[model samples]
Target chain A: EAGVAQSPRYKIIEKRQSVAFWCNPISGHATLYWYQQILGQGPKLLIQFQNNGVVDDSQLPKDRFSAERLKGVDSTLKIQPAKLEDSAVYLCASSLASSGRGLMSEQFFGPGTRLTVL
Target chain B: AQSVTQPDIHITVSEGASLELRCNYSYGATPYLFWYVQSPGQGLQLLLKYFSGDTLVQGIKGFEAEFKRSQSSFNLRKPSVHWSDAAEYFCAISSASKIIFGSGTRLSIRP
Candidate 1:
């Protein structure tokens, strides 16, 4: 099976600019997630989607960041007026949907797009 | 919020030597545990995971981990190391819905 796919691979923009990243999860996977990985740190969850419906997005920066998964398939994460701190690797991941810890499953990640804001 | 800790920020080992990376999690209940590895310019790859039963769990690439409930620890180990093993290692903790991850451990191999 093909793995999750992400685009651009890398990006560079100035502060206050805008950028967007895309992701396509593995076939048959119903859960999708967006995570930010800062240098020397673990990946932090930004949002999660279960069949186009948001399951968790408490960590997302609503003021500048927005994400959507239309038709429960592909997803896009957009950041407008990006800040210096926004320079990080944006990762997209997917998992099989179940329920609870016992029901949920492991996450498969994409290659990720490295974004640098000057 | 629950958290994960990896005390060693960086570790260096000789090529062909044995390797071990420590991970400790803090949670009120028994949470899911996982270890992931990331190479330069690449995304994370799942190394292994421990949900329940049998404290000792094995992972890919000749890696294995021991889950100690008494110690709240899940450490990854390898009998022998290789130059290709150099990468950033991460330990993550997950509940039914939410998850948390440790900062990470940088493994360096000396040839």
Candidate 2:
């Protein structure tokens, strides 16, 4: 089975420019997530989707960031008017939906897209 | 709010030496814990997880972690380390259908 896949392993953009990252999760996985990992820091949850609908995005910077999972398959995250603080690696992860064994299912991650906003 | 904490930013250990990385979490209910390792330029890989019953969990690459409810800690350990083990390690907690990660610990190996 293929693991989660991400595009443009690395990206560079100027401040105030817009950037987008793509993610194709493992087949049959019902849950997808986007996270941002600043240098020397852990990945922070940006958004999470269950099927085609968002389950949580409370931590996401709504004013600048947005994400969507179309058709409940692939997902995309976009940042407009990016700032220097937005420079970080964006990681995509996927897991199976809760199967009554608790909500702690194992998540598979992608290589991540490193976005450098200059 | 739920959160994870990794006290060590970086750790250096000689090859073949024992290794231990610390993790702590804050949550009111029973916690679902996980340890993941990320190689440079690679994605995060699950090392192990603790949900219930067992306090000590063994994982791939000879890694093991013990959950201490009293201390609210889950520390990863390896009896004998290898150079290939050098990577970034993260501790995470699952709460309310979301997972929160610690800042991470960078492991370095010395010959």
Q: Which candidate is the best by lDDT?
A: 2
Model 1, A43-73: lDDT tens digits are 9999989999998899999999999999899
Query: Model 1's A-chain: what TM-score?
Result: 0.96
DockQ for model 2 equals 0.64
lDDT of 2 at B61: 94
Clash-forming residue pairs, model 1: A101-B96
Candidate 2 second chain TM: 0.99
Q: Taking the tens digit of each residue's C-alpha lDDT, what string does model 2 give over A30-110?
A: 999899999999998899899999988999999999999989999999999899999999999999884443256688999
Model 1 residue A105 CA deviation (Å) reads: 1.7
Minimum summed lDDT over a 10-residue window in model 1 chain B is located at: B92-101
The native-contact fraction of candidate 1 is: 0.62
Which residue runs does candidate 1 get wrong by more than 4 Å?
Answer: none
